[model samples]
Target chain A: MTAAATAAGAAPRRSARRRLALVLEPYLYTVPSVFLIALIMLVPLAVGLSYAFRDLVLLDPDSGGFVGLDNFRTLAADAAFWNALGNTVTWTVSSVVLQFGLGLVLALLLDVPFRGRGLVQALVFLPWAVPSFLSGLDWAWLFNPVVGPLPHWFVALGLMTTPDNLLSSPDHAIWGPIAANVWWGVPFFAITLLAALQSIPPDLYEAAAMDGAGAVRRFRAITLPFLAPTIAITIMLRTVWIANFADLIVVMTRGGPADSTQILSSYIFTQAFQRLDFGYASAVAAVLLVLLLAYAAVLVTLRQTFLARR
Target chain B: MRAHVLRRRLFRVLHAGLLACFLVFALFPLFWLLKVSVTPNDLLYSEGVRLWPSRITFDHYASVIAHTEFPLFFRNSAIVSSSTALLSTLVASGAGYGFSRFAFRGRAAIVGLMLVSQMFPLVMIVAPIFRLLSPLGLTDSLTGLVVVYTAFNVPFATFLMQSFFDGIPRDLEEAAMIDGAKRFQALRLVVLPLTLPGLAATLGFVFTAAWSELLFALMLNSSAAASTFPVGLLAFVSKFSVDFGQMMAAGVLALIPVCALFFVIQRYLVQGLTAGAVKG
Candidate 1:
């Protein structure tokens, strides 16, 4: 009787240990990633946010002093910052709109079953494989009149009075990078939208067609509603991405020709990378982060409200 | 009926035409790159706008390969990108497995943090990362690029892997565990084999991202010895702005690995993203 009671007591203790291990197993698997992200990305992000308040300059031993909004004060008065902010709006809006518009058209075209569709899809999406810097350079070379065909084509088409480098003109220089960005980013939108498009039930379209709906009518009734969610989420995410995208502009224009092509991201790059002014760059970055967060928040709330109504 | 037939025929023609336009637009720059690379220096400016050069030569390719720092840059890029891919995939698989198998405390919060990480402006951390890594003797090092790229890639890769794991049924591993196996062993033996494709897609995706990365590589590694291809190419552009043929040759070389990987993995990427869309 005494041995039996001892055995029963030990059974619960063993099971409890097993239960604890099971609970901890997930953490064991997940903790390394959490630890690394926190250490490498999150910690640096925090430090960067703090750098906005301090005077931090690269290679300057004496510059790490608490500045307490001094960077912000300077940024407020800075004409270049304001210009970049304006240009950022132009850049993000134009790029997102153009990419979405073209991508939707491409997706719609690809949706219809046709011969050699696979080959066509592969060919059209090829530009996305080009690296951003290379895309920028490629487009830049195209705009150069000396060796590129674009200027000659433009002149022949009467779109330009001369075979001049479009990249050198301050008034129209932003378009150079924008064109590159559109080329590189269109495939991303097309792929996502195409997936969403494919997911819609073919029966819905068939049923609508049988009810005497035309192509436009079917698209309006069935396709638009199904695509609305994906479109919203994609455009939101892409806006944030394009706004932060500096590589194309940096490589293509270097924010030159009177800083006309300098969006907020490139401006931040310029301040940090070229000027080595870490504090000011972080300040600009902090502002950009806040703006992006606000934009995202507004989008989320709009989505929530829209969903609730639906 | 006759009008309907003609309208359909017209639509088909228009569709084909539009597709052709898109194909040309998509390929023109790459074709131009190739064209310039093969065009002799004398012919580059003279027949710049020609549909095809009268004569083509591989002299630019030979020179870029034999004469420039491109080989070194390519090596550095290959090392950094591959290391980032391998390490990120490994870490992500663990987290992905965790997210897929267990619903535990803090899971939602962790997922949320990762999503937020995707949105945060990476440019913000450039300076602080520089500061942070400099002290650790990682600045101007290939190891530093690998670490940063791995961390940047892990969040997206984890989500990708989790989606893949979600597609797989839990019963496979459960059966293994029931047959006298530990959880990790089940993962290693059963789930890992199934997840090979997921691992490969993640590897390719991360590799492309790292290979294309220019900013951090440019900022962190200033020395030519440590420079990745993008930085080295940009430097070459500024230093030898007139050498269009050789520069285009180098550019073509940079395009090879990424374009090859992209064609292979793009379908998987699309599937992954679609799965993510439905779930999200």
Candidate 2:
């Protein structure tokens, strides 16, 4: 019996090593991708951090001097920085709110069965399929003072005497980009929320109806809880996208009409590429990174708290 | 009973009306794009808010195709977008599978790090990226644009693919393995076949992303030879006046490839979106 037990143990040990080998083999498949990611993403991240403290000029190609905190100090006093920051916050918050509100409303409306339902759903999702740059340009054309259909429609309808180029003014320029963003973003929220809406079992609604619950009451009791998780995740993703978005701004305004529509991302581009101040740009970027990290952390915490209660 | 019936009908009518309004609101821009594209340049401003132009002509499309650099821009965009899509999908699939199935020592850390990567604004890192790429003789090249786009897009693509993989069950692969197949064989035979919708979705998403990408293309490539369509569109905007008709014509033309690609891959996209919507 003892000898038999010893042989069994020895056999299992050999198989365990084989299992280890098997696991290692699966991991080896990921090596090429991991290496490339490290090279392109991870290394640049490290370089960015290091460059934030070093004065690197684009023209000279060899001029890099270590200047700790100077970039941050300069950025502190920079009026454009404050304006961009404010614009970025406004863009992110308003776009996110309108996106969620309109998306939720559309999702709710689509939740009910009606004629041409599939066609309506597809049409509502059209904006998402269009390219962001093209969308920006499209909006720019629509908002064009002379030839745009929007201002023309407004004037024809007696909303204004003359066509206003909204993108030309500081106050309205930021809203132009926001309007463009909202057009593109609402579809994602609608789709995601609609998915979440569909996942709630119909039986629950039937049961609520049997219990004499009305439409709004049933939604309050059953639908909202089930959709909360999806809503939270979608909002987090949209916030991140909006906060860092540059293409739309670049295409529409170029952070222009006197930098009124400049967000952090476009501002960083100007600092780095246009001004040729790599170090200062890096510092600004680093600050942006920290804020995003904080935002993500808060989102994760919120999600955790929400989940913990369940 | 009659009142209840009337209320139900009212609700139905309201729902349909609301959906119709939303649909029109959403699709108006696309409709206008098509409307303006076919409208002659002469009546662009003078037409004054007509739903359809007084007369339609294909002159702008003809001119854009024949008279401008539109074809070259389209070709360059196609090459860059398609290559980036294929290459990134391949890379992302491997990484995504690892993330979905494997339980390595640093798996959680790696996933977290990838999330962190998404948080950094691209503008923040554009300088360092340019600096790094300049030394490799990649700046102002199509290959450079592809590489940068692939790098920027892979993380999101990987996450997207990973979600797809996670939706697929593990039992199929285990069954294949039990049937005397090696792990890779099981993956190739059973898993890869099931992941086709995911692969197609990732390809389409990455392709569109790369095609429409302008900022990096603008900052990275200055020469006309390597310029993509979005960058090419910038040429229409000189210091003095913007060419609205030609730019709109070019924009309309640029939509064709994306529309065509989406049409081909629409099946996969629908499948991908609907796959994880409902529980099995």
Top candidate (TM-score): 1
Residue-level lDDT tens digits of model 2 in B4-117: 999999988888788778888788887787888787878877884788988998887788789888799899999999999998999898888887778888777767767777
Clashing pairs in 1: none
Report residue B226 deviation for candidate 2 (angstroms). Answer: 1.8
Tens-digit lDDT track for model 2 on A43-79? 8888988888888878876779898888889889999
Top DockQ hit: 1
Residues A97-154, candidate 1, lDDT per residue (tens digit)? 9999999989889888999887788778878888899999999999999779999999
Tell me each candidate's TM-score. Answer: 0.94, 0.92
Q: Model 2 clash pairs?
A: none
DockQ by candidate, in order: 0.63, 0.48
